[model samples]
Target chain A: MNIEMIRAAQARLEGHARRTPLLNSPFLDEIAGRRVWVKPECLQHTGSFKFRGGWSAVSGLDPEARARGVIAFSSGNHAQGVALAASRHGVRSIIVMPSDAPQSKIDNTRALGAEVVLFDRAKDDRNAICARLSEEHGLTLIVPYDNPLVIAGQGTCGLEIAEQASAEGITKADVLVCCGGGGFTAGVALALEADAPCLRARPVEPEDFDDMARSLASGVIERNSRLSGSLCDAIITPQPGNLTFPIVSRLAGPGLVVTEDEALHAMAHAFSRLKLVAEPGGAVALAAALFHADEIEGEDVIVTISGGNVDADVFRMALDKFGG
Target chain B: MNIEMIRAAQARLEGHARRTPLLNSPFLDEIAGRRVWVKPECLQHTGSFKFRGGWSAVSGLDPEARARGVIAFSSGNHAQGVALAASRHGVRSIIVMPSDAPQSKIDNTRALGAEVVLFDRAKDDRNAICARLSEEHGLTLIVPYDNPLVIAGQGTCGLEIAEQASAEGITKADVLVCCGGGGFTAGVALALEADAPCLRARPVEPEDFDDMARSLASGVIERNSRLSGSLCDAIITPQPGNLTFPIVSRLAGPGLVVTEDEALHAMAHAFSRLKLVAEPGGAVALAAALFHADEIEGEDVIVTISGGNVDADVFRMALDKFGG
Candidate 1:
């Protein structure tokens, strides 16, 4: 996918999805020691940026294929995204989500009129489950981050960031994107590289699940051995996507990682100052902006808060511990 | 306050504050039985609509008056707002706050560079304190609301709502405004009356603290007997402001009131669906939108989320009780 494809995705998404706002806080700027523009994709459909890719993929499907429905495997955000997108297209959807996923995610996905097939997180293979289910149901499998159209779809967010930044007269800047399978980060980077060459993308992740960061540094695809317990569960991909890695490697800088505590602090700050609900995973990039301020390359920065679907318990804990 | 004064306030606040987005969600709309556009003043500077009024009041002051600084008496959002507004103008601020106010609010106000004077909530009269301080130190006392400039400043939010609704091709609408001293509601109503006569403002309040509702009905300033114990501490004004009551009574509908539980549910819904952090007081209008949907008189509606200075424990309880 190139600039044209990304622009096509942006046009396709125009009326279908929201153009989430770029938020700014003078107080937050004081904290980060720089001017920061926050893109709240938490306000996106399905409460995450995954909705962009899901909608893009679903909407791009042929009439017959769309009528037959689609299938995807994700523990939370992606599942809800695909389910909502398919429902919007008047298509049936079957989502293979982990049984251990938050009850809210499962319930919300099901509420969107999708059939939820919950597999055991510890034992069942989600990929295998999705494959067998898709084949049996004759459904198109919507890979979360590995498709060209989906990559282009996610690229629209980057397009907005670049457009918004440029509109704000920010020419030389860096965007800190929270990374999962490198889909969002790669797409954003490619769009920025193509459209606004002055802006750069910096991938951010939680400490242990920093495969994208390591991969960017090592100039190769690096993998995380364990991802079962990271606080930033939304962006805990084992490794960067095959389609996304190349674009990310070429267009983005070395990844930035923040600790669990820093992410919690970022979430708290978002709650008290920005007045936005930022899930811990969604706030990693914010953590990078606030805590790793010195490491970021530019004066003007964009921090992508990618999702807001935190468990009530975890959110309460963050508020209690890091509030004030 | 008239449209011209409100426009002047808007012009004065152009480069200083945020024009917070008017958020919409299909899910929230479904719950309300109509298309509901949420104006989250939660995103305003100092995390509430008070900043608009504060900035308006402070900026409207003469150069010499601004140089001498200002004094305000409040426990939470308004204090912080005045402090922040004063700080922005390079003016010194002295806030007389109750000792029982949340530590977070007090800390945030101080952090914004205000000198905080803590008085006992039960024993001390904040009005007397402010009066004495203003007279003794020659400081201009910035009333939280009631003032014409502050009301005009807050009217900018109403103008934005009307303009946004018109932009979306909505001509007839009901705007649910959370009511405390009626300043915001009256200002918004007056603005809507002048600019977008097709739109109407509806004042919403907590169940027992329905002074605005009763006052609107009786054409008198009805006061709440108990003020300090309501969960919505931010908007627990004893009665509608002397200056603001007449406008609100004449312009708004019979005020809508919601139960505490409904307000808490609104807060939880805001956290999960709108991905906005709304304090209980802020969520009152949302409660009216969600729980009192039938009473709201238009297909196109606007819900004002007034503030987001909730205590961590209160927010946690809301999330736990009503969060998905």
Candidate 2:
């Protein structure tokens, strides 16, 4: 929650986490009608920004706690992030994943030497299962968001963006980030508030799954009802986290939402022009930058591609549907 | 090209070109059975290593020479690189391109403010046409790879790899470079010889168009008889350049050739794992690194993804054919 903690998290994750590049595309700039700088977390360790938080949380633990290991519940970028971070420290990790989660995420988490407990999303409660496992094993629970340590870890991304943007002579800009449970968005908001006040951080989400956007607007935590099936499965968390909601609501500006079609188009553009593989969830901010350009008031805009671990079939479909 | 000229080129291209990241993948390392590092020039300005040569040549010109502008013949990465570099310098660039070249390349070159003169590759001598244009317009002729300034510009890639590898505690490495006219490979060879003698540079080429491989072995320039049908069209130069061959022959080790399938697989791996787009020609070195691991002898292996300017259809086929 503080800049010092974020700096500490950055130091803890240094050399382990990749400082993902700040990319610029003239093509995207043309579409956005301003300079567009992209922070591609798709290139991060474990193919997402989750690695920064995972490493920060895992590495920040006391040696005794680290030896006892950790447990968490997630089936997306967070699973692989925590798994990789735990393995790096020679600590055991157990990820409670949905039974029908993408095979790649499960396999990758296992490959990182983490034990995966599969539960049916329709029939079983992942949180209850994770709680039982954590208590039974006397393991620390590393929350996907909400946890101060995890938020501090995610805040490093904001710090990096500020430093890199400053280096590129970007003193002030409109920065758009993809929001899932508001973990990264809140962290980025806090970091920007401390380090680079010039960068106005906003959360972008899928049309139907705009929990964080609604939360910021209504001045309370919000939840998404099953209205429409979304392609951005990586970020379909039902509600904003208790801890993350306050940070985003207090520190961040307004949020934006983009359609599934727009996200797919952004994915295709990333493939063709930016030369980056972005999952649907990761492409939301880009969708906003490209499709809702007129609403973005700034000299420059920074969009974050949050992850790149989509199913092969899904990627092929995006390329087929929207690619030139 | 000498080290001094390369240093000068680096100085000239300080903020003009991107210092592309050298990426490592555990998945690639597991397949290669050794540590493998990749320098992705696909992230370079104009989407390829050609920009280095292009910028180096354009920026190296005297002020009056720059005023008359420059001309070159190529319908690939070079065309866009030259066009962009010339535009940056506020100079006129006339690109003599093949009529059948990819539309994306033509559009990009023209978008960068170059005047395009399309000619039949099968019927007209592109060099003759370029020469006539240069004479008529009093424009400086920028050879794609043969010029020392261009080669020196390309050598900056080698300098960066050495510096980055040394930072990672890599002392000795086997570097595989994609070869067309051997500008990049030869420049890399010279730069490595000067700064990082511990790293050995090797040339990689498409299977049938293995002119650099043959030239390295025979002590004479060997030409590929036919090239129109090759998938690696960006790098299908008939033979090694006169200026480049000698440097590569003198400093670099044996050359390697990869099949079109292998290059496509490399492109897919770059897409799926490294999260970078790589053209077929750009992916050849990666193919050599991944598939020809047994032949490489060093503490670590390094491969360069030289470009990312393939047509959408070509890229889609690469993803479908080889992606996970």
Candidate 3:
């Protein structure tokens, strides 16, 4: 919520997190008609920036609570990130996921040393399962994006962007962030406000799932009717988090929305030009930066590729449709 | 080349060359049965480490000579490297490539601000064309890996590895390099010899194109009988360079070789786990570290993914066969 808390999270994540580099390609700049720099958090541990938040929240727990173990609910990137964080801290983790989730996600979460509990999306109540498990095992639940410590952890990436941008003599630019529950956008907005005020944070989402954009425009929280079926499945939260909405509304710029095709195009460009793998959800910010250039203001823009955990078939589909 | 020249190249390349991170995956470690660190130079400028050597050679020329421009003969990575380097230096570049080379490579080279002159690989003499063009334009011909300055430029990667390894508290390990004309291996070997002496450089090549391994064992230069039919075409050189062979022979460990299948497998792993796009030739060192684990020594190993410029079909083929 504040710069000090984020800096405190940075202290906990000093050596634990990978300080991913800010990468750029002349070809991407040409396409965008402006300078384009990408912060590839896809290269972060567990192939996503979620690892930052996972570690931050896990490590921030009291010694007794950490010893009691942790629990989380995520069918994708968050599952893997929290699992690995808990495993590394020598703490047990119980992940509650929908049985309909990708098998690879289930396998990868378990491979990272978590005990995965699957529920039916149409039948079983996920929250009840998590509640029972947490109550029985005395496990602390690591919320995906609504927690303050988690936001602080995600803010570390913003600090890195500020420092890297300064080194590149980039004092002013729109910092596009992939938005879900808005923890990442809120965190980045807070960091940039305190450290690099000229670099404003902007949220980007898929076309149909533009709750953040609607909420920003209406000055009130908005909700999406559907969350599934989008190519950018990883960031399809129904609405922005209560804790995050206020921060983002105060400090961030107007949100932007991009199509699934634009996300695929951005993924292909990331693979071909930046040599980085980017899932559709992680690529929305990059999509906005490259395709929605007219909506953006500035000679240069910084965007985040938040994660890279796409299935092989989906990845091939992206490359096939977009030409890597 | 000695350490001083490499240090000087490091100075010149301080901001120009990307200091790619040494990335690792717990999954890769599980497969290798040891700690494995990968330096993904595939993320470097021009999608290869070739950019380092290109810039070093071009920038090392006298101001007057550089003003006259430069020329080079390459069918793939080298052409793009030199073209980008020359273009960045505000000098002209003429790249001589075989007409049979991949169309994407030709287009990419020209896109990087180079004049492309294609010759028939079967009948036309590429050297004759290069010589004539060099004489006519007063352009200095930049050799790919044989020049001392080029080697020095590549050595800067070794220096970075030395520092990164020391940071990780690794005093000893085999540093694997994907070998072609041996310039990269030789440069890294010389760098390790002076800085991280306990870390040994080892050359890795495709099974059919194991000229560096053969030359190291025989204590003389050896040539491959056929050069055109390998999955790792980017590294199928005829023989080790006259300048590079001696340095590698004196400083590096016995060489290693992996099959085309193994390279494809490594590429898949890089795509899935490391979020990196590695071409077949570039993945050879990683292949050696992973599938050829028994042939290597120690608890830790460092490997380089040299480039990422595979065609979409080839990449799809690798993914289809290896299951990215």
Candidate 4:
């Protein structure tokens, strides 16, 4: 919500989080026709920047509240992030995921010391299920994007980008961030506003899941007609969070969107040039930076590769399509 | 090469080389049954630690010699490393490679501002070709692993490891390095000997191309029977370097070798757990650390992913074989 709160989250995250490298390649620079600096958050703990928000929210909880445990409703990156954070914090984490979720996701969550509670997405309301579970266990719901602490935690990435950019003598650039429910976008925009005033944050999304882009264009909250089917499943929320939308609207640059193919292509480039694995959602910002260069301004551009918790087959498909 | 020379290279490489991150995963730790820290040199410039040695050798040249440029004979990581290094230093680079080498490799070297001279592997002597090119162009030969300054450059990676390990409170551990002609292994060993004496460097190689290992066991330089068939082609040198062998033998712990299958399996794990794109040659040290855990003597192990220049098909095959 604020720079102080984000700084506080960064204090909690010290040593616990990996201050991932700002990766670049001449190949990428040539392709984009500009200086491309990549913040590979895929290399972060839990293979995603989600770990930052997870740790922030969990660690920010009061001692008594923290002792009761926490719950998250996700079958993807957030589940693993919260699971690991809670385990590291020595508290039980209950993850509510659809039974239809990939077995790897279920297994990975459990492996991170979380109690996996599966629900039928088609027949059961996940929110209702989470509410009941939270009530029964006296657990705090670790909202994925809507919470203040979570936004502050995600803001830590923005803080890193600001410092790293300054170190590279980059004072001004458009920072493309892959957006799900706008927590990362809003957090980064706030941090950049406070720390690196000239570096602007822009939300990037998949073509069909461009609710943030649409919302920014319309100057109001917008919703996606459909989700779930995108290759960028890690960031396919139906709508931007109310808490995050206001902040993004106020401080962020216009949102950008890339097609699924573009995201996969960016994933391949990330693999071949940056030597980093990036999930489709994680690669959307990079996709925008590489393919949508005309829409962006400035000589230098920064992009956040948010996660790499991708399935092997999907990653192979990406490489096959784009030739790593 | 001693630590002072390494420190000098570090000074010359202060802003040019990437200080790649030390990445880890609980999943990898569980598999290794010990804490595993991966120094991902694959994320270094030109997607390998070779850049360190390349820059060291090129930058250490006298003004007249540097202006005359540099030449190297490699179809893989070294070619790219030296090419990029020379280009950045505003000097011409000539790379002599086998005509049968992958076209991608040839094209990539050229794209990095290097002049590529192809020769027949069966009939042409690459060393003679390089010698001719060097004389014709008044170019200093940038030996891949044998030069003192090259070793000093690679030693900078060791310096980083010692500092990072100390920051993590790791005083003692085996630092597994993917070894070819022993340049990287020797450099790291010399640096660790001075900085973190408790951290011992060990050379890792592919099964058949284990010249470094055999040389260490015999307490003398030894040669491989053949070098072209290994999947880890980047490290398929015929023999250990004369300059590197003595330092490695004196300062290094021992040598480790892993099978092609093990390297591929480790590559899969790196992609899955660490979100790193590690080629088979690069993954050998990680393979040794994970599958050869019993052979190692420590609760913590540090492995370097030497390079990530594998073809897309090869990376997919690795994933298919091991399930990333």
Q: After superposition, how far is residue B60 of candidate 2 from its true place, in Å?
A: 0.5
Higher-ranked by TM-score: 1 or 2: 2
- Candidate 4: residue A263 Cα off by (Å): 0.8
Per-residue lDDT for B256 in model 2? 96
User: Which residue segments of model 2 deviate by more than 4 Å?
Assistant: none
Q: How high is the lDDT of residue B304 in model 2?
A: 93
* Residue range B132-184, candidate 1, lDDT tens digits: 88888778998877899889888989989888888788889888999899889
Worst 10 residues of 3 chain A by lDDT: A315-324
Tens digit per residue, CA lDDT, model 3, A268-301: 9998899999999999999999999999998999
Worst 10 residues of 2 chain B by lDDT: B310-319
Backbone clashes per model, in order?
0, 0, 0, 0
At residue A194, candidate 3 shows an lDDT of: 85
- The DockQ assigned to candidate 4 is 0.80
Selected candidate, larger DockQ, 2 vs 3: 3
- What's the TM-score of chain B for every model shown? 0.98, 0.98, 0.99, 0.99
Instruction: Give me the runs in candidate 4 sitting further than 4 Å from their true place.
Output: none
lDDT of 1 by residue, A1-324 (tens): 788888888887887778888888777888889898999999888889999999988888888888889998887888888898898888999988888777877888898779999899789877888889887878999988888878888899999988888879998988999999988988899899887999999899999899998998988899998978888998998899999999999999889989999999999989877888888999999999999988987777899999998877788878988974
> What are the clashing pairs of model 1?
none
* Regions of model 1 farther than 4 Å from truth: A62-64, A119-138, A167-171, B120-125, B132-138, B169-171
Candidate 4 per-residue lDDT over residues B68-139, each given as its tens digit: 999999989999999999999999999998899899999999999999999998899888888888898899
